[model samples]
Target: MIETIVLDIGETITRDDRYWASWADWLSVPRHTLSALVGAVVARGLDNAEALRLMRPGIDVAAEYRAREAAGRGEYLDDSDLHEDVRPALAALRAAGARVVIAGNQTVRAGELLRGLGLPADLVVTSGEWGVAKPHPEFFQRVLEVAQAPARATVYVGDHPANDVFPARAAGLRVAHLRRGPWGHLWAGDPEVVAAADWCIDSLMELRTIVGG
Candidate 1:
């Protein structure tokens, strides 16, 4: 049975709607336009940030983010940003004696915001805090440390295949490919994704059965 369940932040535990909407407003573009670009980039198997560069060539995304912060607008998250099933599913998992962790490729501020929410997690961390990001074995190693469990006993759950499925599986941890977000649904039926995933889940609640307490 899975003793530790480590989840990705975007799309797995949260909607990611606010994050993209913030960027769209900052770039002075309609939300749908930015959203479409993101889709196109991801379809090409490129990082989502490439969308911003496509919208404004030679754009310095990090600098733009800082500028947004200075202008009294920046990354933000709250209860409204969480998925409808997040709280209940996480709480239930903890009650079932699983070590629940929220780790992902997010900025340090995102980690702070997540921690402030007091989610039912053993640890809430971001790549910015550790200076390592997903698809990197080191990130999964950190996750194992937080989990305090063997890799085989840990299950990494996320919506992205490159960042979540292939890497985690290669790192020796079980992986659950969540078919909820754009990436999730887009690659849901991909032969590679389907084969790589230990389990393919559509809802967080399904995890209750997988962990089986």
Candidate 2:
């Protein structure tokens, strides 16, 4: 039985359109240009933040983040940013006696924003809070700890193959590759992603069937 469900934030629980657009505005770059650069890095398996550095060589990305906030535009995700299926799906999972956790590689301010949204979850945490990011073994270890259930009985769902499918599966957690984000839509047909994910789903609503009532 899937007693716990852990989900990634960006492009999993939410759409990433606003995120990329905001960054483009912050950096004074064209939206399409920033988006294309992000895809390039993602395709090359480099960190997405490399897109920002690529836009402004030697730019202090972290400092820029603070500046953006001080200028009244930092990390922001509102009700509209959440995927339509998020609240319903999470609520159903909890009603089925499953623990729902929202975990992802997001900033501390992003964590505060997420918690402020009050999504139906047992816990909403970020890598900034944990000091460990995905594709790292320690991150999955912390996932298991938050789950408080055996890895085999927990499911970790996300859009990124390298960060979500492989490592989560390797860590003994059942994996669900969600096909809603760019990384997901782009890599959905990749052989390794297909092999690593125990379940490949197109929407969070499908999760109700996976865990079952």
Candidate number with greatest TM-score: 1
TM-score against truth, every candidate = 0.98, 0.97
The lDDT of each candidate is 0.93, 0.93
**TM value for model 2:** 0.97
Query: Which ranges of candidate 1 are over 4 A from the true structure?
Result: none
Tens digit per residue, CA lDDT, model 1, 1-213: 789999999999888789999999988999999999999998999999999999999999999999998998998899999999999999999999999999999999999999999998889999999999999999988998999989988999999999999999998999999998889999999999999999999999889898993
Worst 10 residues of 2 by lDDT: 204-213
Give the lDDT of residue 119 in candidate 1: 94
Best by lDDT: 1
Q: Mark the regions of model 2 whose C-alpha exceeds 4 Å error after superposition.
A: none
